[model samples]
Target chain A: MMLKYPNGKPYKPKNQTPEQVGTGKVKDFSFGNRGKTLEEEINETNEYYLSRQIAIVHKKPVPIQIVKVEYPKRSAAVIREAYFRTPSTTDYNGVWNGYYIDFEAKETESKTSFPLKNVHEHQITHMKNVVDQQGIAFTIVRFSKLDRYFFLPFSVLYESWCHMKKGGRKSIPLETFESKSYEIIPGYNPRIDYISIIKKFICNKEC
Target chain B: MMLKYPNGKPYKPKNQTPEQVGTGKVKDFSFGNRGKTLEEEINETNEYYLSRQIAIVHKKPVPIQIVKVEYPKRSAAVIREAYFRTPSTTDYNGVWNGYYIDFEAKETESKTSFPLKNVHEHQITHMKNVVDQQGIAFTIVRFSKLDRYFFLPFSVLYESWCHMKKGGRKSIPLETFESKSYEIIPGYNPRIDYISIIKKFICNKEC
Candidate 1:
């Protein structure tokens, strides 16, 4: 028994029970990653992948504009006055199966659409450059209200971006994402297994 | 006249003068990049390439471990206490012409060897991982005293690293670098056209 969209289609994304996905620490999918954000879960997944030789990925450390630093006698240098720098690209990027993969992870509470305002201009340009270089680029959108995660390829996002640039709607509707994106189920070891979706959709483009 | 190493070999790296390399702003190579370091020159070169749509290389921002933050204003969050985090990979990495490139730029005043101290343990593992994944990996060594730049491929560095792991010499002799690495001449437009060296040495591997 799930709710229906205005277009009459069901809004549920392959409903997987917590028993099917969780192992120990993260047993509840409804809480949206067991008290962690989507980004943290993905970072843990990346670490899991790197340790196991499954894949190599990393969240680019958040850029910070360091204004001043103080080196204490026997302590680490402490950054005193600093501001967060505008990110020039996506959050995560690395080598995956001998191919480059760049992606941004975002979460929204909106039920109908994922707003474009959450992403930056330079980030889109970066994704475009990655695509032009034949790299696999995508975005992971998590709808917190629905406890749903979807992996949207750059191709689809680029189209929507272009449409927005041409004076179109700025947000990608949930229905639009429903048809175009791949659903990501949360699990214990890898909270988000987005690589499976990448391998399925992007392997041909890479090889 | 060229200086001689202890073994009586002439120290030379395809000698090119400032007049040959410079066009406008970076004319005085005798100052060794107009008071700018080798890393700065490489960063400028990366920006030049990025602006021209030639490549997408970026110096990963210095990682910092933030322990505290203060909301100084309603808008800005000022980092109060944070320490610099140890980076797990090299300083630079990107996608170039559909191939992945990872590298570290280093400088030394010592005329004998590029000290292994300049390279870190995790960085070596990272370069190995990049090579294992069929990506092009290398290091840029700027001999400041000699005003020479050499792009040493991971293959060459890996060999030295393995030797060190077996209790061999910790530094790679400049003579060995002369034989194995590509000498990069400083230039104006792209401060360090290391990509040219990449084209010559790594293009084949990528293709």
Candidate 2:
């Protein structure tokens, strides 16, 4: 029952209950004290969009390459040996209103700025590729401490990440993000109504 | 070093070669084979499609929930513990020519029939959901031993599966598949060349 990474490092479960483990200083700024994680909220919103036939977006399942499986008599097959595979892209992707939508959802505790290290190189490259294909690529950044959310476009993120890499600031300032990114207010019905912003910013003009 | 399924079954790797797997005896009538596995061919085809700007498709990474990690001296992070997560849908999905395409790549060896078990219930449900939203959904079944391929629509597969579950034939006979499915001729460039058939069968009238 011991889950270890390929290098024998222990894996951390991100889905632990807030009560089971302290919130660890990350202040969630998004609406009420509802303990739902960002991913759970987005998943709920995706379900809402799907039910309405408004879009067909889904969170890509966590990727695990199964190396071994045991089929016991009259029971579900059990995986015995598995290794973690490095994913090449961000989590969520699908089509909406004839536009290919790709995004990564991230939560942060810092109230003043979002750290550049939170965005990986592979993700940036993925966003670039999607944008090159004329697809709408963005990231849903939730400042947990500030309870604020923003949809940052790929171009702006790429520029900021690149700048940070070359001796620039380690984090993107809140003022810059506020000015450049589309603010997404969280709600009960659809936790992250990002597509509406997409319709306003990317779809109406392009498609 | 032990992987256990959620149901407490020990994982074991199937010892059979790729040729020995699946229901290949049915017939050589599935798609995706140029002397390589479907995953490799799909990767190549995705690259080709990306280069040509014809589509934006990708294979979702295998989902692994990491439990423990060891950052050995910062150079490498060795995953010491991880568990495989059950994927809720098919492996590959994306958009092509404004149509949302979703499919699962499967290889079988039986020369007479394809077993109903290879396709999972959740995958069927996902495909149905996609079809309900007017998306193009199908499975790319490969008879690797015979080096033949076929594209079976979700509707046909669903009906056959339902029948199989209700005390009908346990496997889909080759004759039924051949008569209803579109044969995809494998090639060097695209490997599957499925879009051509899609154009012929699914999009020609619209155009």
Candidate 3:
């Protein structure tokens, strides 16, 4: 059954994974298929980091607008009606060391490029605002097909988004990202040790 | 209509007010009845701090689970079915000068004491976890009727909550707060300047 919005517009899920797409040239890292998705793995890694008192970061819970609820008991309340709220910013934000860190994580099957549509306008604006306030803003883009991850700065994402708006292209070329972005090699313990890269490259010098 | 939880137990909306009823000791502070709430005022204060590069703090958005939505072609999306999700932590958290700060803002009408029930179990647990991890955790209690504010540290809150569980009392006495807590005098620019107090007490020694 096709999902349609109240106004008859086709409903599109915000973050959908490209399932059937095969892996590309990028290296694939496994955190074990313990029924945990990439997002969940990243969340666990964040928890690990928090537990170690190494950094303070958290995934912002999905925003929902609740309308109706059914109270069956004192402890468990079941929601009867709800709708998703479009977030104004990325999925994750916190302070690491002395810098404010804001970022979103996305995985894609496309080998050649990363889609611009994956990054929402509101998220871009939010990142711009953070950068304007001198906060560190970036995205953790995972080319799942290639099993590769890159931390792309907000500045680069902003420029690419503008280009896309001007009818240039819908995706950022892989070559462009390779040169400008910091590549995050996955590890066994942390799964995605992107912050280590950040500490080595960004925070060490800037802070 | 009385609200009942899923377990068939009647759910009581927490009556959060000062413990000493009608003492008229706690002062009153207003954000002006201009449609903006205490949360918005705090958000504005955070923005001010961000602008000045003094501190980084934010109010986590209320979590909701959305089951349905409607998208009108020319208007904003309307949530059709939604329910409120229990938050696992305090309302606000961030870092300043390398010290992790986490807090919850609550308003009450009574004058003598703050109700222990004003806070949730999960929030208390989260605060305890933060404290265990060596992060600063506290609550910003605003006596709306009296227009007074106090920053009650997690250590004190945890102690009071434990006592309440042991059938000691349902609230924390105002006298106890007045003696142990830091009184935050409201101002025009930054509505609640708790960070300044933190700078004086916590950050100066640590950072």
In angstroms, give how far residue B133 of model 3 lies from its true place.
Answer: 6.3
- Who is ahead in TM-score, 2 or 3? 2
**Every model: Cα RMSD to truth:** 11.3, 7.8, 9.5
lDDT of 2 by residue, A48-89 (tens): 998887777889855554545555676444444443455567
Instruction: For each candidate, report its DockQ versus the true two-chain complex.
Output: 0.26, 0.25, 0.18
Q: Give the winner by TM-score.
A: 1
lDDT of each: 0.77, 0.72, 0.70
> What is the lDDT, from 0 to 100, of the residue A89 in candidate 3?
65
**Candidate 2 wrongly placed segments (more than 4 Å):** A1-36, A48-54, A64-83, A159-172, A202-207, B1-36, B47-54, B65-83, B159-179
Residue range with the least summed lDDT across 10 consecutive positions in model 2 chain A: A18-27
How high is the DockQ of candidate 2?
Answer: 0.25
Candidate order (TM-score): 1, 2, 3
Q: Proportion of native contacts in model 3?
A: 0.19
lDDT of model 1 at position B105: 88
Query: Second chain TM-score per prediction?
Result: 0.81, 0.80, 0.78
True contacts kept of 1: 0.53
User: How do the residues B1-207 of candidate 1 rate in per-residue lDDT, one tens digit apiece?
Assistant: 343222232322223343332122333344545667676789889999999988898888777655556654344566776666677888888888877888998998899899888888889998888777777889999998888899999999989999999999999999998998889988888988988888889555556
- Could you tell me the TM-score of candidate 2? 0.73
